[model samples]
Target: MKRFEGKTVLVTGGAQGIGAAMAKAFAAAGAGVVIGDIGDAAGQAVQAEIAALGGESLYLHLDVSSEADWQAAIGLTLEHRGRLDVLVNNAGLGPAPAPIEQCTVQAWDRIMAVNARGVFLGTRHAIAPMRAGGGGSIVNVSSIAALGLGALMEVAYAASKGAVRTLTKVIAAQYAREGIRCNSVHPGPIDGGMLHGVWSDPTKLERRLSRIPMGRLGRMDEVVAAVMFLASDESSYTTGTELTIDGGAAVQ
Candidate 1:
């Protein structure tokens, strides 16, 4: 049987980028997939793509920062699939690079709401259902920024991710005995999508690339594979851990 033949996964911010990749991957692995994102059009497009691939999926309008949206999304998933086997807290915001001193309070709050608070809310709600069902896995998409390995700028983004990192550990420790597993994935300088906007300048892009010992930006599929492992039974023994997929950048 396929690894996830009887599973269901909900991927937040799944309309694009790594979140989209995770949604596709889970469906391909034989899970019923749910794509949650604020971008209705893009989210529907992803749902269509999964359908075309003969995968079962649904798209839900979700603003990760809102408690109502989280409740609704989870409610819909349980209504449709009966049980949620995995939750990917992949929604996040990467503000334009700015020094801490120059960062506005609004920008800081916005980042925290989406990046940090969103994870908290998702985890808070997902746990009860998971426990009732006997088990579940939560794969949180954090960042290399949380490790203090990002550019000198991005203070707010870094702080927000740091919250996600700690929160992952707390959830894992609190719920391990209940069969619920929680882990965080930290990726660095992923190519395309969000990074395209961050590294729009050729010189800046090259400078960023130079920092990675791999001499290139990481691929979305690479990160998706890590998330898939964490989500599957293959990682049954793993929890409360941080998996860094940074192309050796974090080491240097």
Candidate 2:
């Protein structure tokens, strides 16, 4: 349907997994895409794939935890696309799962820096260009753990994503008057490199699957579909709300 014709969308962590999925979806639906990620090679690969499909795209190096990188990325997007219609903050890191007792200051800081601070910085910098364009949408990729301990062993991840969820509301409420929409997406157990280090063992995988009501893991495209909705005008009336793509697992 070419839902995003003439619109330029910027996606963080666009190199692979959920972020890559969103980039592909937005480009396929006719949005000019800017794939921002630390994964330079993967980002370029995705950009190339998009171009092959006749989609407009560019891959820019973006380290979400760094303000300098954020500024440079925003500048590059403006220079390349002229204007940005949507911003998706999807970059994050999941440290080796550990209980709060074992959570060192470094681990906590790292998680907060990427999962929480990254979103904060992304929205702050995005507001300027978006407001200049008359308005825009901001979508933060949170996690089901933010809804509350969906299971266990995710203390740090939960704390960080929880901050993301609240930060989203703060942005939504503050910028609603400026024609900007801010929302968060909480997806559960998505299979990919991102989920690899955590659920690599059969025991862990089965243990997680047993709790999900749907008895299956989430797909990258599924999460991307939700993200696209929140990123597009289709979610015109939605803001400060979290769209959970957890196959009912968040509820269980």
Write down the lDDT of every candidate, Cα atoms only. 0.91, 0.90
Q: Which ranges of candidate 2 are over 4 A from the true structure? A: 197-200
When summed lDDT is taken over every stretch of 10 residues in candidate 1, the lowest stretch is: 145-154
Runs of candidate 1 with Cα error greater than 4 angstroms are none
Q: What is the C-alpha lDDT profile of model 1 across 92-189, one tens digit per residue?
A: 98756778788899999999999999999999989988988899999999988888765554889999999999999999999999999999999988
Per-prediction TM-score: 0.97, 0.96
